[model samples]
Target: MNLPKPSLRVVFLLAVLVPLIGAFLWLALTSGPLAPVPVTLTTVEMRPVTPTLFGVGTVEARYTYRIGPTYAGRVRRVEVQVGDRVEAGQLLGEMDPVDLDDRVAAADAALRRAESGVVAAHAQVGDAQARRDFAGAQVARYEQLLLSRTASEDTAEAKRQEAQVAEAGLALAVANLESAEQDLVRVRAEREALVQQRANLRLIAPVDALVVSRDAEPGSTVVAGQSVVEVIDPSHLWIDVRFDQLGAGALRADLGARIALRSLPLDTLPGEVLRIEPRSDAVTEEFRAKIAFSTLPEPLPEPLPRLGELAEVTVALEPLEPAPALPNAALHRRDGQLGVWVLDDGGPRFAAVETGARDLEGWVQIRDGLASGDRVILHSRVPLRPGRRVEIVERIPGLPR
Candidate 1:
């Protein structure tokens, strides 16, 4: 059979394959595959995160008191409502003053009458002194007349008896005057007490605080010493974070803390540890850590720390031990092996990894195949081969998650 030997088309095809096969053989002998240039990737991780402890507590007013009156009386008018800021000596509410006002007036009138009595007593004293002098002089005159016999003995004796009677009357008048003076003093004291009662009827705030709760409404019959309103000083707000005794030693006063409030989840307020209670709370049986905000965060629409609200406090610490860490995105599982994509001089390389701990900070500590400050890919779409080529681009700014 005559096969068309080696046509021009067949020759051209053979010619192309001959060199291509040789080149392929040459590449296999030299290197199996060309090395991939290392990719530059940025990653974030925490070195061996030493164990840290945190505490959760409630915010409260440093000075919380239930104010009431010393004496019980019906409330007539309430001057404040819940959430009102009050200053020291600011009037809060008024009690019914009908009875108190009447008592004050009566006491004042009695005081006035007593003063009049004092004047009358002074007059009586003067009169008594004059009578006493006259009586004494009459006795002297009687004695002299008796001795001279210028006056009859019976007449002198009668004058002596009359002078004795006048002296007794004068002493009685002086005693009456002293008694009236004392009565005046007592009446004046009662008037002072009445004045105090009148003042008490007008209830006033005992300290600077914000009113929290108002138990007494307008026209509500609130007795003295009853709670008209509950007030708290926002400036004096503090947090009590209870921690176990195990975590107490690390927590010192004035330590920097980050607090997450339940009300405002988006924001965190910076605070300092005010103090740590040496003794654990009796009810909670946990060590209490007190913290106060440096300043209320600006742009906050309302008070971030509400009284009696649950809050979480995290005590930040420097790592005692450091382990190689990388961003979680660089890790993958293959054939029951946890592997990470590490960029080397030959681009992205797959290496087995041993992970130790993971923190909420998105950092995973690696026990193997990574070092601190090593750059790794954050996120990659394609599967990583041992010697795959890759290109890295710096992260763009202002990108949405």
Candidate 2:
């Protein structure tokens, strides 16, 4: 039996509908939501990784000297300006004397008077001694005359009393002399103290240093202990760096480092870890360290690194043995698990990984859940899940080509 022939309209509708459905399916599978995610892949390789800690720091002086007056006073004159190199014991500035000179002069005068008093007392003692000797001689002569019946007993007794009075005067003169000497000593001590106070008024450099700041100028009044001139040991500059505590387990003194100053970006100065601070920043969770230059910059950078200038530091730690490792970019956290999106014949799947130390070059050591030659996704166009399909690419768009 022959089947009924379809109409021309039906034949046209059938032809259009078939190609439309085919195009929709092709678009969905190739370039639409159902398409495979594009990604960059890296292989886990066996290699040694040199863990390095990166930190930000500021230039600081190991020894900072703040020159100021010991007493509150006005600045008289400043001998050094900011950026000036100074030698040890060089005078930096002076404070106003404000009658201090007069005080010292008065003490000197008092001391001189004391010395003159001492001289006068010595003369009195000598005169009193002579009078005592004369009176004693007269007493002996009168007693001898009385024994020979040529002088009376009253005369002899009177001479004896005169001698006793002379002896008392001598004792008094000697006591006066001791008083004058003590007064002289006290006056001398006051003069020396005044002289020392005068010396303190002059601000002097304590070491060979570079003047970093001049906080006060001529005629500026400052309180005691306030800084007038600030100097630092240019040869002993260091960076006060802070690194994340999580990555500072191996940090220690004597480790080599590279320093890049914000002012001099292109220059990488060689440095080393001078010391690790005993205290850590509890709030920021960072460890503090001091990094010193292995060799100071030749001729020292013009306008030497200002105190508090920013710097970037990278410290090289101990090298690790060869182990399975991959780019840190492959790491991911899913449902509180540290893992990576690993690619296999089946497809991309999340594999929980136990990670070890990471290095500055973006490589992380894989302790478990990965092996050498395993492929992992480094960068993906979209978030991935288990059984997700991916298309490998040389590099991802929007990143460095």
Q: Give each model a TM-score.
A: 0.63, 0.72
RMSD of 2: 6.1
**Can you write out model 1's per-residue Cα lDDT over 361-381, one digit (the tens) per residue?**
656678877666777765543
In candidate 2, where is summed lDDT lowest over 10 consecutive residues?
297-306
With a 3 Å backbone cut-off (N, CA, C), the pairs that clash in candidate 1 are: 37-347, 38-347, 48-323, 68-225, 69-225, 72-224, 73-224
lDDT of 1: 0.74
Most accurate candidate by TM-score: 2
For each candidate, C-alpha RMSD in Å?
A: 7.7, 6.1
- The numbered model that scores best in lDDT is 2
Q: Residue 83 in candidate 2 has what lDDT?
A: 87
